[model samples]
Target: MKVIRIAAALLIGPDGRTLLVRKRGTQAFMQPGGKIDAGESAAVALVRELNEELGLIVDPTEAQFLGEFSAIAANEPGFEVNCQLYRLDVAQDVMPAAEIEEVVWVDAGGTDELHLAPLTRDSILPLYRSLQSA
Candidate 1:
């Protein structure tokens, strides 16, 4: 199985909601990110991805490292994904751009209704919830 290495962000708003985005032609909503390019640091990749995918400007130095996680890939049936995830608490406005078709702000604990990527559902959200309760 192939491994997709990515850098993603858990974007939190002033209202305490987190953002999830659905790419065009994809059913499962996931964190806004993309594959880490060769020689690019995770934070830099995440900042670039945020700008390209969500039309949001961010500083790489401000992204709080939330550790790495791995799960079965959401869109690739036989592949896996390893994500370098970060928590970014920002109140900036975001619009879906590039491949993103839809964006949603959801309560961290109230995401049962949406079809989420496996990485988001099985790992990231649980971690986020635990961090919230800490």
Candidate 2:
């Protein structure tokens, strides 16, 4: 299987909902991030993606590394994403632009109406909930 190295972020709204986004023509709602580019650090890639995908500017200083998780890619077949995830406690007002089709904020355990990316359904949210319970 192919593996994609991506940098993803968990953005917490003031109301405590976690932000998720769907790309154009895609059904799964995942974190607002994308693949890391060549010669870019994970943090750099995350900052760039957040700007491109959600119109939000993220300072490298505000990112809290949440380690990495891997899961089958949600939008790709025979692929997996190794995600370098971060937690940012601040919520920048996000508008869907570029390739984003929609945005939703869901409780960590609540995804009843949304189709979640594999990294989100199987890895990120579970890890987040576990961290909260710790």
Candidate 3:
């Protein structure tokens, strides 16, 4: 089995919604990031992925490290994904412009309605809940 390393962002708006993207041809809605390139730092990959997938330019200084998690690949079989997560402040008016089919804003309590990738549900959602309580 192949292991894939990915990076993702929990982009939070002032309204307290997190940005999620449903990729082309997939039912799952996940955080706005993707696979890390070879030799690229996780943070760097996250920034690049966000820009490519969502058309949002993230400042490295604004990204706060969340954690790392592992899960079975959401869209692939016989593979697993290790994800590095980050939290960042995002503008409310941003739009997704790449391979993303749709963009949705979800709050921690509403996660059940969105079909989420494993890492997003397992790792990132917990953080969102914690943030909501804080």
TM-score versus the correct structure, for each prediction:
0.97, 0.93, 0.93
129: Cα error in model 1, Å = 1.1
lDDT of 1 by residue, 39-99 (tens): 9999999999999998889998899999999999988899999999999998889988999
lDDT winner between 1 and 2, please give it: 1
lDDT tens digits by residue: candidate 3, 1-134: 79999988888998898888898999988888889999999999998988887778788777898888888888998899988888999774766778889998888788777788887888778878899889
**Candidate 3 or 1, higher lDDT:** 1
**Which residue pairs collide, candidate 3?**
none
On the 0 to 100 scale, the lDDT of residue 88 in model 1 is 97
lDDT of each: 0.92, 0.88, 0.85
How displaced is residue 100 in candidate 3, in Å? 0.4
Instruction: Quote the positional error of residue 98 for candidate 3 in Å.
Output: 1.9
Best by TM-score: 1
lDDT (tens digit, per residue) of candidate 2 on 20-112:
999999899999899999999999999998888888887978899989899999999999999999988765789898899999888866886
- What's model 1's TM-score? 0.97
